[model samples]
Target chain A: MAEAVIEAKGLVKKYGELEAVRGIDLQVAPGEIFGFLGPNGAGKSTTISMLCTLLSPTAGTARVAGIDVVHDPARVRQKIGLVFQDPSLDDQLTGRENLEFHAFIYSVPAEVRRARIDQMLELLQLTDRASSQVRTYSGGMKRRLEIARGMLHEPQILFLDEPTLGLDPQTRRNIWTHLNDLRSRTGITIFMTTHYMDEAEYCDRIAIIDRGQIVALGTPDQLKAMVGGDVVTMTSTQLDAAAEEIEKSFRVTPTRVDGTLRMEVPDGKKFVPRLVRELTVPVDTISLRRPSLDDVFLKLTGRAIRDEEAGDRDRMRQMASRWMGRRR
Target chain B: MSVETATKPMAADLTIPVDTRAASLRAIYIIWYRDILRYWRDRWRLVASLAQPLLFLIVFGSGLSSSLGSGTLFGARGGLSYIQFMYPGIIGMSILFTAIFGAMSIVWDREFGFLKEVLVAPIDRWAVAVGKALGGTTQAMIQGLILLVLAPFVGVKLSVLTVLAIIPLAAVLAFGLASFGVMLASMMKSLQGFQVVMNFLMMPMFFLSGALFPLTGLPGWMTVLTRLDPASYGIDPLRRVVLSDSGLSSAVVDRLGLTINGHVLPIPLEVGVMLAFGVVLLGIAVVMFQRRD
Candidate 1:
């Protein structure tokens, strides 16, 4: 097995009385793509902040790239590269200038820095627009430039906090391609977080965090398997009656949420037809699909990952982005 | 995707040793260089910075000079012009504004998330604090120098010796103000908060610094406020040196210069007080930045 590049033992972070991250214990092997999959306000960002040595853990301990994050944060910072969820590029500077400044501050050797800057620009396919100020770049280009800057120093472990958040699907795919290319070429350990379930499918392993705690951890398939089998979701005006009828007729347990009845079956496609025909109560809608990260979250937490209760997290994300915007 | 085989050679690549002191110095240099580069790129800022100080020198000075007449204004000679006395004060105001606003870049950086970029780097946080302080100081001093070019027009005599003397004096004032600005900005969470606080603090400090008038004839309570103001110490020595070669009579010069309890504060001691303020504030800024980050 590869050595763990990042390891934590019950790490916790508190902002006064609010516990943002609570007892998150995990490990990432060197050169693996590790994803902290969670919805907003699930403590994903707070965990990344602690591991990246930006915020000290209020309790417990963490080691990134073999250095204790608290005992020696500088060493951890040296070994890790962080691509913030919020864009950290100086909009006033050109793409090349931004990379050059990062190179200098990271103390990359002068001779090596010049070559690395060119190499990064080319690798990220940003050579053509490298001379333009960052404010002129499109959102995708700006994100690519930020990633390029983060990788310029060749850090052993890279922490990306929702690298593709708020991006369109096409742009998100482009960023993923770039990230995959970089990972293939450098073999650096990539640690990232995202609320998007499909994005987590690309990770070698994932930890599902919610409400400041890790509820599940495994490869995507393993997590899905934990949900037992395929999922059938049905909605009816009388969800309780529909659920009771489906359970009694199909010999499968069903959970009622809102006006919907959800159940895991051996084969959702095979079972959905029977469920609709045999249900005594009229069904408004019925759908069947493979168990996903969302299903895994539902099974574990008894609530949809992106439930309406996420208003606080949405507000917090907005505040953070607005604060970041106001600085410029 | 077990990557152990792919990671073996990476161990060799990651171990490139670095000299800690040299790396720390390099970080400071890069931060300082980045600041100067940004300032250079913003031509409008440089131009706009001159407007307020010049307005004070031309509009305010001219308006007050006509009203007060050519008699002693601050204790200078009977012939010493109001424009001349206000020249050093105007320069002092320029330095104060430039330095304080220059440090405001921190608040901007924080809001923009650029502060996180710098803070997350491996270098010492103190290096960042000191580099920023020096960057603001250098820019502020340059603004003062630009204002100095108008010295002859204002009837303040200038020679090579006096010009050379003004450099250190202006630098002391700039550094002190820059450090104070950084200290205040370090504790600020938002640019709006910083602006509100600056608006509250700046006018009083500039007014109490005795920049527009002499410190000698202020009321008892105002005298204490002036003495407590660090800019007061900075402005007094700057006025004394810049006007010493203005050909003012000794009696009028004595009358116009800064005095406390019937004793004139020596130039070196005043410079020392400003230096102390600069160092102490800079130390505080470093502490605040380190703690916050």
Candidate 2:
């Protein structure tokens, strides 16, 4: 078995009364791409921050590159590179200057710094824009530059916290391509947190997080297998009462997705006969499809990830209001 | 996904050995050098620093000198030209302001995540603090010197020898102020909070330091306040050097106590005191920063 490059045991973080990260345990092996899948406010960023030594855990321990993050954070930082959700590059600096600045901060040798800067520029396809200031670069270009800066030190482990969070779909795919190339060429372990289901599919292993805890951990196929079969989604005018009746007769769990009722059965086509006969209300439309990451998320959390996201937004608003009241 | 293997070389071929300690020092130098380069590129910032002190000299020196009529308005010190008396005070004020503002950049750095990058690096946190303090002090000194060059143009005359002698004193003062600013920066969490403190605390400290006028002119209560001010200690020696024909006095007998001769020894006692202040402030800043993580 490969050695673990990053590990966290019962990591917890709290902000006053609110527990941001309730106890999460994770392990990423060397040369592996481990994706942390969660909706907003699911403690994904908090966990990553603790592991990277940017924030100390309230209770628990983490180790990165064999160094105890809490005991010796500086040592862990030396061996790990972090790409924050926000582009942290200085806006006033040119692309080349930014890499040079990062090289200095990481302490690469003078002789190696120049050559590495050249290699990074070429690798990120930023050679033409190297002389231009970062403020002028597009979003995709800025993200690419941030990635280049993170790798300048050649750390053993790289932590990307939603690296492509706000980028266009085309730019996100480009970032994924580069990420794959980087892992293959350098053989470095990658620990990334992403909300996008398709992005999670690219990882060798994924941990689905909800409400500050990991609900499931496995490969995509393994996670899908847990649901038992294909998912059948039916939209009805009376979904509230009909969903309960369908569940009773079908002997399968049915979750409400927006205004639709969804259920997973061994064979959706064959099960449709029983579902229609058992339903007390008329169905407006019916659709059958294979199980998806969204279905797995809903099955594990008992609510769709979208609903959890909205719940978090409301919680954040309440927290903000309390803080402002205290200030006044 | 295609697991396309590279035909070039294995991991063994790319392995290169390095000394960890040496690498960390190199990283610190990079952070320091970049700060210096940024200062150099911002010509307007440099101009503004020089202009502030000159404005004081041109506006305050001329207006106050004419009103005070070149006599000993304070009644405690010897009769001297107002322009000569206020030159050193302005220089001290310039040094103090520049140092404090220079350290204020830490707030910007923190907000932008630049400070976090340095804090998480392999090197000691003290090294980062030291680098920042050194950079801020150096910038303050350069700005102070530029004002010193414009002194004669603003009607404050001084011999080249006197100017040379005062540069070292200005540098010492700059280092002390910069260290204090770093200590404050580490304590304050946000840019807005720090700015408010700077305006409320730092501005009053400068004005009450007797930077623009002698302590004797103020009311009795204000005079006592000035004695307790650290900026007073800084400006007193500098004023002595600029106004007196004997260069600067080593001692002065006053009602409060005997002001020891700052110029008597090989290195002035004031310089030693300022150095001690810098060391203490720097120690506090480093301890605070390390404890924060």
Candidate 3:
């Protein structure tokens, strides 16, 4: 297992009375694309920050690249690269200048500094725009520049917080291609956090965190398999009547989420036809598909991935913690 | 997609043979250099910073100098124009304002998240603090030099040697205020919060530093304050350099200078106070930064 590039046990971070990360234990093998998937304020970033040495855990220890984070954080910083959740580029500087500044600060060797930056710039497809100020960059380009800066130091592990966050889907896919290419070429371990459920498919393994604890952890297929079958979804104007009639006839209750009745059937394709012939109420729409990570999140967490009301409450809590001088 | 992984044992790249001391020094220089690049990039900011000092030197200095009617305030020298006396004050004010506001970059970084990137760097926190102080000092010193260009127009002249001495002295003053600003800004979270705190601390420090008036013959409490103010020591040295060319007797220069128990404070001594205060304040700032995580 390549000595576990990152290992955490019972890691917890607290802000006064509120705990951002309760007790987490995980590890990633060398060259693994491990994802921490959780909604906002679900302790994804706090756990990442602890591993990156930006924040110390209240209880427990994490070791990155064989160095204990708490005991010798500076050495850990030397071995890891981080892309902040927020855009951290000095947008005022040209892309090449930004990379050079990072190279110097990270103490990249003078002889090879220019070459390493040039290589990263090319790897990210930012070579032609290298002399342009980051402010002139498109969102995806800026993110790519950040990724290049993160890798210029040639660290063993790279931690990206929400790598595709706030990017258009097309751009997000573009970043994914770049990341996969980076891993195949250098075999650098990638530890990233993202709330996008579909995005978890790109990871080799994922840990689903919620309310400061890991609810589930596994590869995407393994976690989806936990839901047991294909998912069937139906939306109707009269949800109450449709839910009653379907349960009465089929004896299989469908869960209600966002005004849609969802049921997991052994054979969703066959079941959808029977339901169409037998259901009493008129349905607006009905669909059958394989279980997604969102269904997995729903099954484990009892709420959909894009749980807006809960998200707002979590956002308020995060803001309060930040006001108290803690970063989530 | 299959990774086909070796994790490519980055052995050649990993062992760069680090000299931690050299790395720390380079980190400091890069951080300082980054600030210099940003300063020049914002042309409006560069021009805007000097505007207030110019307004004070031309409009406020002219207005006050005429109202006081030249040397009426300085009974001893009898030839010191209000503009000449206030010239160094305006320079101190410029440095003070620029240094304090320049520290806002630290707060901006915090609010915008760039600070976290720098904080997580392998370098020591004190290096970052020192780099920031140097950056702020350089910006303030540049503005102070621009204010110096206004001296000739105000009818005050500087010998080549006076300008030479004033250069480092001006930097020292800027360094002191910059350190003080870094100390204040390190503990603050938002730019608005920093602005409020700076205004509260900055206005009093500038006004009470005896920059606008002579420190001698002040009321007891104000005299105590001006003595305690670091800018008082900083500006008094610049005044001593400028007034040195006035060919005033040492008695008049001493009267114009800051006095404790009727002994005029010497340039080396005043400079020593400013230096010590800046270093201590900078130490506090570094400690604040270290504890921030």
Candidate 4:
């Protein structure tokens, strides 16, 4: 097995009474694409911040690239590249200028700085637009440029926070392709967070966090396997009656969720035909499908991953209190 | 396999460079360079910042000089033009405005997310504060130098010695004001919020620093306020250096010099206080940033 480039043991971050990231442990191996999957306010970003040394953990310890983040943050910073959740590019600067400035900050050798920047620009397919101001680029181009800038210093590990947050499907796919290419070429460890389950499919391993704690951890297939079978879902006018009939006939308990009868079976396709024929209550619709990350998340957290603005106020309140805590 | 072969050699030797003193200095230089690049690119900003100060110098100076000239302000028995006195204050005003606005860009950077990029870099947090202070100080000093070209027209002395003295003197004041700007901007998250607070404090600080009026013959309350203002020291020395060598009477020079409890502030003391203020304010800014994300 490859060695772990990132290790966190019982890491915790609390703001007043709110534990944004409760005790959690993580170990990401070198060259592994590790995914942190969670819904909004699930402490994904907070964990990233602690690992990146942008925020101090209230308790526990973390090491990035074999350096303790809190003890030697500068060294960790040198070893890792971070692309923040927000757009951190200087809009006033051209792509090349931004990379040049970043290279200077990282103390890349003067002899190789120019060639390295050129190589990064070419790798990101931004060689032509390298001279154009970032303000004029499309969102995808800007994202690609930011990734390029992050990689300019040749860090051993790269942390990307919501790498594909607000891009189109094509751009998102392009980004994943670029990330995959970079991984294959450089073998640099990648730790990224995203609410998008589809994006998590690209990871070698996934950890599902919810309400500041990890609820599940494994590869995409392993996570789905934990659901144990295909998901058979049925909507009926008499959902309670249907659920009882399914349990009686199939000897499997069916969960009633939001006016639907849902059950996990070894072979949902075969069971659906039997279920339709055997059910006593009038079933309106029935469907059988493979378990997805969304279903895994739903089963674990009892909720679907949604783009929620309702939690924004709560998150802001948590941030304000965190800022106040830092002052002390 | 072909792609890995092409890139692996370059990526394989990932050197973990320690963050030494030289790296910190390099960080400062890079950050300073970025600020300078932005300033140079936005030529309109430099032009626009000069407009308000020029208005104060030309329109306000001429308007006030006509009314206040014959009144023996600062004990000018030989009828020294009020513009000569107002020129130094205008220079101070330019420094205050440029320095504060330069500092306000920090709020803009924070809002735009660039501040986070700098904060997360491997360098010392103090480097960011120091680089920002130097950037703003340099920008404000440039504005002051531009304004100095108009000094002769306003009846202030313009000699080799005077020019040599004013540049560093203005730079010292610029450093103090810029450091003050960085301190206030460090706590702010939004440009609108920073602007609101800056406007509230800036106008009062300029007015109370004896930049627009003589400190002598003031009421006890105003005297206390002026004496307490650090900008007062900055402005006094600048005004003294010009007036003392402008062939003004010793009596008039004594009246124009800044005094606290009837003792005049020496030029060296004034410069020293400004330098100390710069250092302390920068220290506070660095501490504040170290605590922030």
Candidate 5:
């Protein structure tokens, strides 16, 4: 469609000896909602930081709104709105004051600033509480306020790093609805990062990053289709014998994972019954299910996406490096 | 939620194109204005910060006045007393502590996560630093003004003209000192680290400044260090202005005056030094902010 709003070529970020984002390449078209899906420490935030002009890439180049992030970061900053993973709102300021601060810095003209702010507050359903200090708002309200602030400047692309990370499930869904609504109304481009497999379903396209590289990138349905038909999993005490028996009998390899034998077939319903009847080994239990985003992640990354503790540790290491960098 | 609450048409209008220069100026003003507004909202912080200047002016000034024999004659009767001699020092101290600590607001902002809001703005980083410095300067100057009420009790004279003269110098000193604080705070990222810096760095700065005593007759090394301390330059001009109107003897003024190469630093020169100090430190702070936080 339109020329990419955000384009990067082999972008990399290094903190001393550690490479947070090894080498990332991405492109987001105008009006597209793109999501970077990864477990914690997967370089989602790092890549977003480079695109937002908050960090310098160590080994590559990136362009946002056609302005080079490194060559002219100040201009790049003007064209993009960012809602960082961390809580970045000024709690001391009212919700309205917070939006006003963003508007002023982005140089929203005085003539239209008040109207735009009122519109944003009303859009976020914060008009009634706009005058109260931000610290008094609940966590969900704060996230919504941040989203309102991000859209206040009318940037070409909005970057949100883990926008719903710490929110309750209901709040998460509400934010998703608002994002979709904003996209429909303005056709604004959204580039966000999330670990939630379900949330990735909302994006037009998803990039699955593991370690420091994109393991897979496609629409949610397309990625899930890669897993094909249906999945059949069975647990038995003689798992190895059963796996061998099923493979030989059906001519389909069964992979043993977490003490269970899993195999994919065109139709689990047709395959499971025949396998159960034909199998020579006794099975304790068997189940059939459709493939999900989590299963796709598992198949691509070779592990589950529940390593939140790794995420915490990775963040700590990055913060420490940042602090040490400040010293130099 | 009502149907009206559904998302309305948005992102359709003209988003303002930043006039870089004008935006920079606005950035400075809004950031400074925010600091002032926040301080106004927190009354306890304002009242609590007043304690340091008062304790120094009354307790420290009075106790030392008794030990130094009311600062006359090396006790000359009816001459300027020790409390009077250190009055400017107390005001300078007030500005020093308040302005410097005020700059530390950035670190608190960092910890609380609000600093990212400022750091990521499209405007110049210098604007942010300058705005923060101005905010801290205004607050420091106000604290110095608050101590002016205690001047009469300490036996220091104040006319409208005397106060008028003190205001600009104090503001300059506060801006310079606040810039210094902003510079330090920008390099640091933690409040606990700032507490350590306050003790080790701020204590020597106040002590070395002639706010408490004259610089004459100190060890050679100590004299050089005091001369280098930016706080001394700030305290000197204010000292000159306060003792200038007091009719204090030439001897007392000479003892309390800041000197370079044995010549007393003129008021204009002291103000120039302070201005230079503010500019350089704030420049460094701008460069620091330019680096990714």
Candidate 6:
């Protein structure tokens, strides 16, 4: 087994009256891609902030590249590169200048800086746009430039916070391909926080966090096995009542998702016949599929991955209270 | 076959880590250089800073020149033209104004998150502060030099040697004031608060510095207040340097029998005082920066 290059124990961060991160422990091994999977406001950014030395943890300890983050952040920063959720490059500078500026800050030697800049431009396919101002680049190009800049100093570990958050699916896939190639070529450990299940699938292992706590941590296969059954989905004109009847007849949990009835069962194919007969309403369409990461999150959290209402309401109230306090 | 092929490519790809301190300093130089480059590129900003002092020199100095012609008025030495005397004061005033307003860039950086990026870098915190101070002081120094070059055009005679001496003095004052400006920028936290402090503190300091009028023209209390003002101290020695041929001994015996050099000496007390102020303000700014959110 590879040794862990990044480790955290009982890491906690508080923002006055609120506890943003609550005693989360994490370990990321060398040459491994570790994903922090969480919904918005699940303290993923907060944890990354403390680990990256952007914010001082309120309590607990984290070590990146064997250096304690709180006690020796400067050393930790020297070893770990960070690409924040927002692109931090200066719009006034060209892509090459941005990388050069970061290389200088990391104290990269001139010859190496030039070589690395050339290599990264080729790697990111940005040679043509290297001299173009960042503000002129497309979103994907900017993100790729930022990633290249982050790796300019050849840090041992790289932290990418929601790297593909707002990108289109095609762009996200393209970035993922570049990221995978980078890891395989350089053997650099990558720590990423993302809400997208497909993004998490690209990681070797992932930690599912909710409410400032890691609910589960394992490989995607292991996590999918945790749900313990094939997901049987049915589409009916009256999904609500049919789902209710199907749940009553079988000892399976049926969840109403987007005009469809989804239930997990060990023998979905075998149970389909019984389900159709037992259902009071007619099923227009029925299908059995393998469990996905969304199903795993739903099974673990007892709510769908995209539970917009509860999360949005909580976020709105938090924002409103913050606004009121600021006014006061 | 595999071993030889792989080894060659891997060796070519492998890179040794190089020392980065020199690069960091170079980056800081670039940052400072960029500030000057930007100032030159933005002709309007240059024009505004230069025009402000030139207007004061042209209108105020000319208006007061005839009244105080070549004489010992208000304890000034005899044979000094009012334009020559007022020129250094205006230069000092320009330095103070430029230094203080240079801090507005910090506020802009914070709002735009450029400051955050700089803070997150592996460089030393003191380097960030010092780099910013150097950038601001460089801008102010350039403006001061521009005013000096334009001195003859404004009816003030200044030798090249005096101009050379005035550069370092203006730099010291600019850095000192810029350090204070940084402290204010870090403490205020908001643009509105900074604007209020700039108007309240900076404007009063300039007016009370005797940059516009001779310190002796004011009442006894006002003169005492001017003595306590750092800007007043700054302008005194600079004025004496520019108007040195007027037979004025830079040192004066105060009422308390204390001998003080206003500007005649090679190194003026104003430079020392401003240096001390810069150190104190820089110390405070560093502390404030560490504690910033």
Write down the RMSD of all candidates, one decimal each: 3.9, 5.4, 3.8, 4.1, 4.7, 5.4
Pairs of colliding residues, candidate 2: A107-B27, B250-B261
> Per-residue lDDT for B34-141 in model 4, tens only?
878888889998898789878988899888776664556732576567778888888898888788778667878876778878887877889888888888888888
Find the 10 residues in a row with the least total lDDT in model 1 chain A. Answer: A306-315
Q: Which prediction has more favorable lDDT, 2 or 5?
A: 5
lDDT of 4 by residue, A1-328 (tens): 5668999999999989999999989899999999999987789999999999888999999988878989888788888888877788999999999998899888888899999999999999999999888999999898999899899899988899988877888999999999999999988899999988889999999999999999999999999998869998889888878788788889888877667877889888789888878777888998889998988998898787765542464467456744553244
* Per-residue alpha-carbon lDDT of candidate 5 for residues B1-293, written as tens digits (9 for 90 to 100): 23533553342222334578999999998898888889888899889888877787778877877777534433766477777878899889889988998887998888777888888888888898888999999999998888888877877778899899999999999999999899998888667687788888998999998888878778999999999999999998898788776777666677668888898888899899999999999999989877745
Task: State how far residue B16 of model 4 sits from its true place (Å).
Answer: 4.9
Interface RMSD of each: 4.1, 5.3, 2.3, 3.2, 2.3, 4.5
For model 1, how does the per-residue alpha-carbon lDDT over A1-328 read when each residue is reduced to its tens digit? 5789899999999979999998999989988999998878789988998998877899999989888989888777878888998878999989999999899789888989989999999999999999988889999999999898888888889899988877889999999998888899999999999988889998999999989999999999999999878988888888888777777778999987666778999877779888777778898998888898988988898877663444457667678767673332
Please give the DockQ score of every candidate, comma-separated.
0.43, 0.33, 0.57, 0.52, 0.52, 0.30
- Give the CAPRI class of candidate 2: acceptable
Report candidate 5's fraction of native contacts. Answer: 0.73
Better of 1 and 6 by TM-score: 1
Q: Write the per-residue lDDT of candidate 5 for residues A196-250, one digit (tens) a residue.
A: 8889999999999998899898999899898868989999999989988887879
User: Candidate 3 - CAPRI tier?
Assistant: medium
Off by over 4 Å in 5: A13-23, A58-61, A307-328, B1-17, B70-78, B243-255, B291-293
**In candidate 1, how many Å is residue A244 off?**
2.7
Q: Can you tell me which runs of candidate 1 are displaced by over 4 Å?
A: A14-20, A235-241, A273-285, A307-312, A317-328, B1-18, B70-77, B192-196
Local distance difference test scores for all models: 0.85, 0.76, 0.86, 0.85, 0.86, 0.77
Candidate that beats the other on TM-score, 2 or 3, i.e. the better one: 3
Q: What lDDT tens digits, residue by residue, belong to model 2 across residues A95-142?
A: 999898778767777789899999988888999999998889999999
In model 3, pairs of residues that clash are none
lDDT of 3 by residue, A1-328 (tens): 6689999999999989999999999999999999999888799989999999888899999999988999988888889989977788888899999899899889998999999999999999999999999889999999999999999988889999988877889999999999999999999999999888888999999999999999999999999999868999999998999989988998778899878999988888789989988888998999989999999998998877784554476567556755765322
After superposing candidate 6 on the true structure, give the runs of residues whose Cα lies further than 4 Å from its correct spot: A15-17, A56-59, A235-240, A258-260, A267-278, A284-289, A307-328, B1-31, B37-44, B57-86, B245-267
